[model samples]
Target: MLRTPAAVRDAGRHTAHNYHPLPVVISSAEGAWVTDVDGRRYLDCLAGYSALNFGHRHPTLIATAHAQLDRLTLTSRAFVHDQFADFCRELAALCGKELVLPMNTGAEAVETGIKVARKWGYQVKGVPAGQATIVVADGNFHGRTTTIVSFSTDADARADFGPYTPGFRVVPYGDLAALAEAVDEHTVAVLLEPVQGEQGVVVPPEGYLPGVRQLCDERNVLFIADEIQSGLGRTGATFACEQDGVVPDVYLLGKALGGGIVPVSAVAADAAVLGVLKPGQHGSTFGGNPLACAVATEVVRLLASGEFQRRSTELGERLHSGLRALIGKGLVAVRGRGLWAGLDIDPALMSGREACERLMERGVLAKDTHGSTIRLAPPLVVTPEEIDHAVAQLAAVLAG
Candidate 1:
């Protein structure tokens, strides 16, 4: 019988079997590498689903967290803390928005956007309560919350979790015509990921986002962008929406907002839209806690500093070009923006999971989505030499 590590066995026995994570038991991580309990190391190509855009355990974020911890931790929404205003201000400036509402997770940020849109529809757009409809694209992965799962196109996510929240309409992704047909007077917002991260890093057509923005403007509906998985310099820009020069009415932020050290997320918008929520309307106990606020503040600064964004852009081009050279050989195609690339493999030859497993054996770590597509989103801090090494490992894996 194969013996498993005590840590791994203990987790399996005690924890809910919600996730089917890779078998490697991580013991520690720093920068772009993670070491397993058995002392093996691998380049982290997933970056915690882009949550580690700053790389793991970044010194600046750690220092900030340490100082803040000594000062204070949680004060709840019952009272304000010093880090709260700074976090909001910095995040708003980073998003180019007028106001921000802090939350603790990507799902909460998304949920907040939904509530704000509905409230705006009732109070400002004159839609009746429980009648405001929000349009969402198919193949989107917002989060695991019940209300979020209600609109998911993925069967596994929606399978047994329901009584399902209502008031959402589904439209075909990348089809502007479908979206145009779906929207009407009662439509409050269009919530979508700029690039569908979970659906194999699926990128929409060039004009899709700009077109959606225009359509929302024409219909007087709010354009809500769920950038939790794609924003904060993940796609070589501060926000993925910047690629099209479209400023969404509301931006849902999470993941990398915590710099991979804490749970930090927020929703940013102009006051008119987010302002619809009165004091007692919505909040989270840990939202904008001092520790989260400090870490997120550092994250926003690093993202806006343009260092990591440039690295992601430069290395992204290198990685994509290298991977594209394998087309018609092993990879079917490579598609994505910046450091986030999706490798579509020949299904008959090997599944994406197989490719990732092979890569793992060769000292690289990545994840597969859908079945044939593997996503590669290494930390923005990854070096050119590291990129070459990772690509070489992947090339060898495919060649074998």
Candidate 2:
């Protein structure tokens, strides 16, 4: 096995310095845990920013990928592969949509949705060309693309990345009056995350999603939910919109759709909205590759099975209750749903990053976001015993 220092040195020599990950160098990972290059194991509470909801190296997803690799891999969009249709059909059913356009990354899915909204605005809604406006929420993290970052509320993501794209209107999140004030005749859509994951797992006020849905319906605007971070059974449901019983016009999905293996993402919507795309409008070479499609098919099957979702719901309750018990002790507050949670630490006591570093030394792995908030989203496959153990470790770290 490679030593941690050697591994870090090798990566630093070859790869771009884009991330500031924790010091631990992961060598291998399995359900709910990762082993570092030094052979020390830690529970992966972060789960790759909710990308590994199925846990690391899930057996079913790995088997599907292997089988598909032995048979076929890529054909490009110029031609269709055998796995594409079934993947699309199942995903469309899962999304309750009439069409699905595959992509390889969450950012690509968001870009696709943006394009679709613009086209629909011009062609179907009869808006002037290139003049459509999409309403977005403040403090939302869609992706790191230039256009996506154009409307970001974070200074770090937007500072040097400009000159940014335009044609977006930003409003305060969870404020119905502000959202209503932002929409006008030229508004094409309202794009937002059901829960702001990167914004310290900030959940919108109750009735926010449903209220937005109603407002969109009344205003003839497309409601586009960026579910890439919060979807695919991450929030104890197949989709976070299910929590509010509201369905968006466009469902942007990614992350767990690849089953913690390859990158598989898509935009799902009814024909009336998604049908705006014609030939030569948009495409990706490896968007619907055979291996990704196969893996994603099994992912959809597992997500629809209700096992993972149920586990997230139950374990989340236990985790939240445990953390709530520690609020005055060290934690400032706890906010989230299902297996996803954000623990705000009292700044006077310790910072979120400090708590996470301490937790890492104690055999738990998590990441902090928005300065003082640590987001914990363990894989849905984690057992009850593991949840208790993680809570105990966190509590001990806080006590220390």
- Pairs of colliding residues, candidate 2: none
Q: Each model's TM-score?
A: 0.98, 0.98
Cα error, candidate 2, residue 319 (Å):
0.8
Residue 375, candidate 2: how far off, in angstroms? 0.5
Write down the worst ten-residue block by lDDT for model 2. Answer: 1-10
* Candidate 1, superposed: residue stretches over 4 Å from native: 1-6
Off by over 4 Å in 2: none
Per-residue lDDT over 1-400 for candidate 1, one digit per residue giving the tens place of the 0 to 100 score: 3223676777789889998777788889999999987788999999999999999899999999989889999999899888889889989998888999999999999989999999999999999778899999999999999999999999999999989999999999999999999999899999999999999888889899999999999999999999998899889998899998899999999999999989999999998998888888899999988899999998988877799888889999999989998898789988899999988988988988888889988889999988888999999989998999998998898888
lDDT of 2 by residue, 1-400 (tens): 5498777787789788878777789989999999998899999999988889999999988988888889999899898788989999999999999999999999999999999999999998899887999999999999899999999999988889989899999999999999999999999999999999998888899999999999999999999999998999888898999999999999999988988899999999999998888888899999988889999999999987899889889999998899899998889899999999989988887888898989999999999887778999999999989999999998898888
Per-candidate local distance difference test = 0.91, 0.92
Q: What's model 1's overall lDDT?
A: 0.91
- Model 2 TM-score, all chains together: 0.98
